[model samples]
Target: MKSILTILVFLVTFGSAFSQTGEDKHPLLTDRFIIGAGWYFPTRDIKVEVAGDIEGLEDIDFDETLGLSQGDNTFNFVFFWRFSKNKFWSVRGESFSVGSTRNVILDEEIEWEDITYPVGGEAEVSFGVALYRVFFGRVISSGQKHELGGGLGIHGLNVKASVEGEGFVGDTSAGFERSETEAFLPLPNIGFWYTWAPTDKWAFSANLDWFGIKIDNISGGLWNVSPGVTYQIIRNLGVNLNYEFMNFNADIDGTDFRGSFDLTFSGPSIRVMGNF
Candidate 1:
């Protein structure tokens, strides 16, 4: 977090010195398509409670129960399009996924699906989430050297988790035991973005979005922000360095499972982009 703040400060300081005003003075002021791929380092915390038909069990914490690591590495990508005909309007999208699985002896007894796994038995737990988002925006304040915009977006989330072990229950033989949950959600959000260019060759941008509420059986909050600097190496190509942070909390009551899920993923990435 501190490192990201430092980059933001540098962008402001450097941009003010070289910033100029003109219609064609900034590359970002023109319409272009951008594609980028990079790496992501993430941390996660997930929990689920058993309700209704499943009773006499404690809530499950994936990190604590599965002995999952606090950190992991993954891949991410982005696609963006800015229409030249309407310099004020643009569309953007991004996607990423993270997951973990661990095999270890149970530290304590756990009950799921009306079955119980002994404290000394072997267990395997897995958790994962895939995320995708798309949005459209209109540049409300377009200046020669800077621009400000606001828009709405839809974020799609797929959450999956499972537990397997040796256990037994009423009328059931002591053998393999399994319980799992899968949820799909499409959430809408609103956000704002700012872009600054000190010169045609260099630029900086930042954006933030948030949405949350309790309506009916679904409840959760989603937040995301990113800040970055770009340097144009050639007429239609550039290199970018950025920091991204995302955190969300979800409570879903469905036929498969009833509980809550929480996660936070933050990291830095470097990528190259080309514009037509």
Candidate 2:
């Protein structure tokens, strides 16, 4: 009976030592799902060209013509899932929406969709963008401190634009022209991700991804880089501080409306995640 009690004490002490040292489980290694919510600040330039009987009215610059400016600060959401036990594969998705509207007096005559507005007229221009992305990636190399990978993804884009006019000089009543375009593009990308462990309590990470393609009436490219740090407060809970820079350019042509746009968004965000 004395020998049995001694063995039980030894086993309990070993288990307690292992738990305190975290020898069997690392917080990041065991993480399977992460949901992120944050804010985005975007600066943009937009131009649209239309074709019809209207001459000299085909090209419109939202900034110079109507004083449209960059998008306002907004909230964004992201989700990630890791599917490999060895941390070799994963999938991620993100979605964001941005829009802006401006009202100004026209500096020149404008015609759209068979309607003409003379100079000294007032017009309202509104533009919006909704973006979605899904990607599958593999970790080519990984260690306790670093990871590198590459993959393919599809970016879905939806654009909505409209111009409404009032104070027309002549018989053309107050009118509006609106168009919406959507496209889903597949792109192959390469990326490198790195992690640094300053201590068992904190980890710093960064990543960069880029891709470009042109086919048919669609042509565009995308690139993003982000750096972040995570602080583990306990075994399964943590907080993240991240800075992201993103840029995308696309040209689209269709039967309804044809235009080109370039947008840049850069901002810092904070999120909380749990490892399960």
CA RMSD per model (angstroms):
5.6, 10.5
Residue-level lDDT of model 1, residues 6-82, one tens digit each, is 99999998877666543465565574777777777766666655554565657777787768876877788888888
* Weakest 10 consecutive residues of candidate 1 by summed lDDT: 20-29
lDDT of 2 by residue, 133-206 (tens): 78787777666544566676666766666677653324746544443343443445566666665445567788
Residue-level error in angstroms, candidate 2, position 122? 1.6
TM-score of 2: 0.74
Clash-forming residue pairs, model 2: none
Regions of candidate 1 where Cα sits further than 4 Å from its true position: 1-24, 50-59, 108-113, 168-174
What TM-score fits each model?
A: 0.83, 0.74
Error of 2 at 32 (Å): 1.5
Best by lDDT: 1
Which candidate leads in TM-score?
Answer: 1
